[model samples]
Target: MSSVTTPRYADVAVGDALPSLDLPPVTRAMLAVYCGASGDHNPVHVDLDFARASGLDDVIAHGMLVMAWTGRVLTGWVPQSAIVSFDTRFLAVTRIGDAITARGEVIEKFVDGERRCVRVAVSAVDQHGETKTSGSAIVALA
Candidate 1:
């Protein structure tokens, strides 16, 4: 696993790619922990019976949990304060036991007032290469 390094604004380019983070598999226990911390006790995400009754193969992961993984790709590289904004859309359900990879690429880099910022196209893709979430973020460079 490669740790994200702070990007130097002067050396950054629009096409630069962020180091991808391969997250651990989504286990049932992991979902439970996330549920406890996030206070989202949705049975669809934690109870297999509820999931099956709801027409799913098994319990799914919380969308926000997956989104947070995408955010980790940025936070690992930059200070939290540098993040100006982030938004994501849930594209697909991430079922239990699925391995997800967080990916990002510098789509645009420019000046915002006196601050240098970079806009990145970000996504969380499963082992099957299907994207579960897609998003973008704006991060100010130090």
Candidate 2:
């Protein structure tokens, strides 16, 4: 097997942009699988009737699922071992049929306890261009 080479500290810049990951449109089936896998079987996510009762027109996707997509954008750019921290805030509900795209950009570069690192601003946006989730991550560079 071949090892993937991560970016070196000296070769990266503060404004570098990571490749974006575009996900297929969200679907009820996807939500069902995610619900079972994540054990977050909130009725609002899988039950349209329950969602309507909760004041929503239809079932929504789990926030964690969108956050996971952002995480995928991060790890797809850099090895998971390079990630020092990651977090996100749910800004809006993701409805079924909404296509999501995960994007990230290096906002700052610094050294933490002798380890070179970059602070990356990350977000997941729906096809409407609304950000459904926003967060940042700290990634170490060799």
Candidate closest to the true structure, highest lDDT: 2
Instruction: Evaluate all candidate structures by whole-model CA lDDT and list the values in order.
Output: 0.91, 0.93
Off by over 4 Å in 2: 1-3
Q: Give the TM-score of candidate 1.
A: 0.91
lDDT of 2 at 126: 91
Residue 43, candidate 1: Cα error in Å is: 1.0
lDDT, candidate 2, 1-142, per-residue tens: 3244579989999888899999999999999999999999899999999999999999999999999999988888788999999999999999989999999999999998989999999999999999999999999999
User: What TM-score fits each model?
Assistant: 0.91, 0.95
State in Å the error of residue 28, model 2: 0.4
Candidate 1 lDDT tens digits, 1-142? 5554567898889888887899999999999999999999999998989999999888989999999999988897787778999999999999877999999999998898998999999999999999999999999996
lDDT of 1: 0.91
